[model samples]
Target: MNLSKYLLIGLGVLSLHSCDDFLGNKPKGYTIPEKFEDYSKLLNSSYLMSSSNTVLAYLTDDLYRTSRGEIMNENAEGKLIEYTEFNFSGCDDHERNLYTFKHGQVLTAGNSDPLWNNAYENIYVYNAVANNILNVPDATKEQREAKYAEALVGRAFEYLNLVNIFGNHYDPKTAGTDYGVPILLSEVVGDGASYVRNTVAEVYDQIISDLKTATPLLPEVATNVYHPSQTIGYAFQARMFLYMGDYENALKNANEALKLNDELLDMKPYTTTYSTFGRIVLESNPDETFPEDVDNVENIFMRNLNGAGSGFYTAVVASEDLLETFKRHLAPDGVDMRLRLFFATDEANFTMNPSATPEKFKGYSTYAPYITQNAGFTTPEIYLIAAECEARIGSVSRALQLLDQLRDARIKNNVHYVEETDAPNRTEALRLVIDERRREFAMQGAPRLIDLKRLNREDWFRKDIVHSADGETWTLPANDLRYIMPIPQTVLDFNPDMPQYDR
Candidate 1:
């Protein structure tokens, strides 16, 4: 076996002919092994392919550190500038000022652009891996099942993200009438051709179908707490159902994920010193061993990172809005350890431009080093989902109990606790739950859009003015049409069968 070929096969592009050529270059640079029995190699490739752009995504995306002149200025100068000027406006301000981001641009096909190209290219890789696994005949029943499960989960994850941004949420009752991202599971390649888009309902149906089949087949084996599991699949189902307004199934599936992994990282025993608390949350070391020490108990699913290289993840500092909210809720006496663990503010202030006044960023970073991909399936989220679902079902007491349980984990043996009375009854409880979720998961980018959808605040957020650390307010007007990204124009060009999303 050639180590070079093995590494390249998993990481680099050997064939660039077209996406249709999944098995690029005849498996070049290595002698074929007597038996294609290396399931581990295939697994490694799956993980790598999923994580290939982990760092890039964080560096450039709005969910992380602002790519504007202040935070990332020293590192990614020009790229950050373009991102700040274009993507930032597109994402944060609803594409009002973007000169190039026309609704027609996204609706049309055969547009040779980077954004669409990259999305489809990544989908191509997932398709290639799935296709290869399907063709591997020597795989045992167990191996085949595992491979298929991974493929199903991977494709589902990709499609869900794409549809949410490119299309709209699934409304099964009216799915056929809605437009959705193109449903492409195969690795086909061609130039510009006519195509049309599917409805959001069709997209959700496919996602549910894939996950339903995959969850049962996934093994009970747990390699790392961060990686996907049967429970994670259930969590995704709960989340999807919640988005679909199916509260009953949402509650059921979220509870199922919690039952599988409900333990939270207790802050009580380790809160003697502020520095110690800081270590628990912010410090990342190569080998500061403490015997696991109950650190990641609440992590249901995580992405794994092995090195500090290009493809690995990075920390995205928090926005000022999130930081200020935490500060406002901080106990005047300093009893709230979560505030300390989650954020840090430097006394030194700097101005981006000379004419502008200096101000502190009050930036926040992750307390713990988790895998990238800018998202995780955590116990806290499960608890939050449970609270939301329960509240919807008139179980306010049960819902608040779940919320308090998570809140209790963050506060040390205190002088204080979240008063159950303050949490509100059923109707108001729904709003409180949404507020708690926004505060707790700030900048981690979990289901804020869903809350917006539920409250009919989608139009509101898309139109409201959001400010940064420097107090620059970015505004998105009502139903500006950029709330949903355009389907990559190229996708419409090549696939004549695909439908275009309306502007």
Candidate 2:
């Protein structure tokens, strides 16, 4: 009963369909195996499919916060950029940064950039493995079905992230009219490389259809944290429905994901010294080391981007804006120490990177290459998503329950609970929930954008956001085209048949 033997047989089964003749030449000093040798490489690629290294993962944060402003610096020179034209609001206060882009001043394309290219590249590899599994020879019926389900679920998750950033939200009545990304189901090369965009509806339809078909086929869990199973599928389904405004389904799936997995890590177990972000980092809880514990009361699916060298972990400080907001909202008696624990305060004699001149804060370009603590989505986020869906469905109590589920874990000593009186009524409660989400998820980045979009507050989002430093205000205005970034121009150039995104 050696499982190794069975694993090898399984790998053998996986290889027959994955070997691509197109990879004819091995790298220098590398020998081309006669038969497909590393089936696990395909599995590994899916893990890397959406890491911090990929443009798809990191750029989402950059576009949303666009400004380089530090809310903590009262005398910080050069406020974050604000485009004069609402569509270009994030370009810069001067408007000089506007013209270089293709549409809405969003970055168009660059010969040297690989962010967009990497996303597409990931999609291709996933699709290849999926297709190979589907057509694999001599594979067991159950094994093949499981592999197919994994591939479909994995690919669908990739596309879900893709559409959120690259295409407009699905407008049920007009998705067909909106532009989405090109649907590259199979691998292509040479003259056939170019592809046209798929209609937004078509792109989502494919994702929904694929998930629908693959959901039941997936397992309850997988040995590798990277692979998809029933929980990931449900999580994605919940996320998709939330994006679609299908509140009922969103609520259902969100709860479903919670049921399949509900293990929240309680930070209260730690002493006050290690309670803040700074303390937590320097003196981390043993629990923090194994972040992917599915039973981890806070995370659903986390991309493994751990270290300085590839295949390692890198610690990141909370962004300054987020840091200030946390400090501003600091409970008078001080309850939430996560801010202090999560952010680095070695700025005593700190000088901004010379390149970040005028911006005040160092942009990613000038900052050292390390993973931000806020980079990947985490488990507490699921509770937030569940809370949002509950609020949207007018279930204030349900939403409050979810919030409590999250807050009870973080409300510092003696104050085992902080009764949220702010949630006096349903509407106020909903808004409070959104506000709490902003604070809880703070620098993490997903909930804020989703909250703004869900509430249709894109216009007043920034202006309404309080700045602790100066009462300086900023606004993103409603229906501002900038809210939806232009689909990468390279996408348009490659797929001329696809219609351009409406400005």
RMSD for each of the candidates: 8.6, 9.5
In the range 339-455, model 1's lDDT, one tens digit per residue, is: 454333331112224344322333334323222322446777888889989988948888878877876776644333243655456755665576567666543332454344345
Q: Which regions of candidate 2 are displaced past 4 Å?
A: 1-39, 46-105, 112-115, 190-193, 269-297, 304-331, 345-378, 413-420, 445-447, 457-475
Q: For candidate 2, lDDT tens digit of each residue in 236-335?
A: 8887887888978877887888888776766555432322222232134543432223434455565533222211111223334444454433356756
Global local distance difference test of model 2: 0.50
- Give candidate 1 misplaced runs (Cα > 4 Å): 1-40, 46-122, 129-135, 172-174, 188-195, 225-227, 267-295, 304-321, 327-331, 334-339, 348-374, 413-420, 457-463, 467-473, 477-480, 489-503
**Total clashes for model 2:** 20
Estimate the overall C-alpha local distance difference test score of candidate 1: 0.50
Model 1 lDDT at residue 115: 33
Top candidate, metric TM-score: 2
